[model samples]
Target chain A: MKAKIHVYLKPGVLDPQGAAVAGALHNMGYDEVASVRQGKLIELDLTGDDVEAARVRVDEMCAKLLSNPVIESYSIELE
Target chain B: MKAKIHVYLKPGVLDPQGAAVAGALHNMGYDEVASVRQGKLIELDLTGDDVEAARVRVDEMCAKLLSNPVIESYSIELE
Candidate 1:
C-alpha cells in the first residue's frame, strides 16, 4: 500500500516561506499571483494490504509524527 | 482562481530528507513503513478566472521557479 499525505498550515496561521514565494513571483512579474502558501507532501510505501487498517494507521502516523497538530492539518490518501 | 502544485524529486534521484524521515519513523517503531519520500505542496491564489490561461502561466512558473526540471517534477491542479 501507498499513502500520500498533504500537510498544510491551518487557517489564520502565518506562513513566512509562502510570503517569500509570493514576493518573488511579484518581482518576476507574475502579478496575477495574489498569495502563496507552502506545505508538505509525504509519500509512504507501506507493507499492509488492508485499506481500512492502513488508513487508520496512517492517520495515527500523521498525528504522532507527520504533522504539527497545533499549527498544521494533514489529509491522507491510501492506494 | 486557486492553484495547487505538488513538486517532487524525480525517480532515481537521492533524497536525504526522505531518508531521514524514514529513519525517524523506523525509530518511532512504525515497522510497516517501507520507504518515504518528501515533497512540496504550494497553493496559489490568483487574480485571473480563466482556468486555461492560469494553467499555462502556472506551468511556466513551475518550469522557471517552482521546480527544478532536471531533478524535480511538478503537477498542477486548478480550482
Candidate 2:
C-alpha cells in the first residue's frame, strides 16, 4: 500500500521557521501572500495485508515517533 | 479567495532534515516507516478580483518567494 502522511505543528506553537519563510515571501514581492505555515509530508510504501490494522500502526507511529506530541499533530491517507 | 499551498524538496535533493526525522521514527519503534520527507503547507487568504489571475500570481510567488526553485517545488489549490 502507498500512503501519504502529513505532520504539522499545532496552533499556538511558535513557528519561527514558518515565520521566516513567510517573511522571505513578502520580501520577494509576494505581497498577496497572507500567511505561511510549514509542515511535513511522508510518502511511504507499506507491506501490509490489512489497511485498518496498518492505519492503526501508522497512527501509533505518529504518536510515538512521527510527530512531537507536545507541539505537532498528524494525519494519514491510503493512496 | 482562500488557497492552500504545498512546498516540497525536489527529488534528488539532499534532505538531511527529513533523514533526521526518519531516523528518530525508527528509533521510536516505527519500523513500518519506509521514508520521511519534510515539506510545507501554507494556507492563506487572498484579496483578488479574479481567481485565474490570482493563480498565476500565486505560481509566481512560489517561484520567486515561497519555494527555492533550485531545490524545491510547489503547488497551490484554491479553497
TM-score of chain B of each: 0.97, 0.92
TM-score of chain A of 1: 0.96
Stretches of candidate 2 exceeding 4 Å from the true structure:
none
TM-score of chain B of 2: 0.92
Model 1, A18-65: lDDT tens digits are 999999899999999999999999999999699998898889889998
Q: List the residue pairs that clash in candidate 2.
A: none
Across A42-65, the per-residue lDDT of candidate 2 in tens digits comes to 766677668998888888877877
Distance from true location, Cα of A48 in model 2, Å: 1.9
Per-residue lDDT value at B59 in model 1: 98
Q: What's the CA error at residue B63 for candidate 2, in Å? A: 0.9
> Which sections of candidate 1 miss by over 4 Å?
none
Give the Cα lDDT of each candidate.
0.95, 0.79
DockQ of each: 0.90, 0.59
Candidate 1 Cα deviation (angstroms), residue A29: 0.3
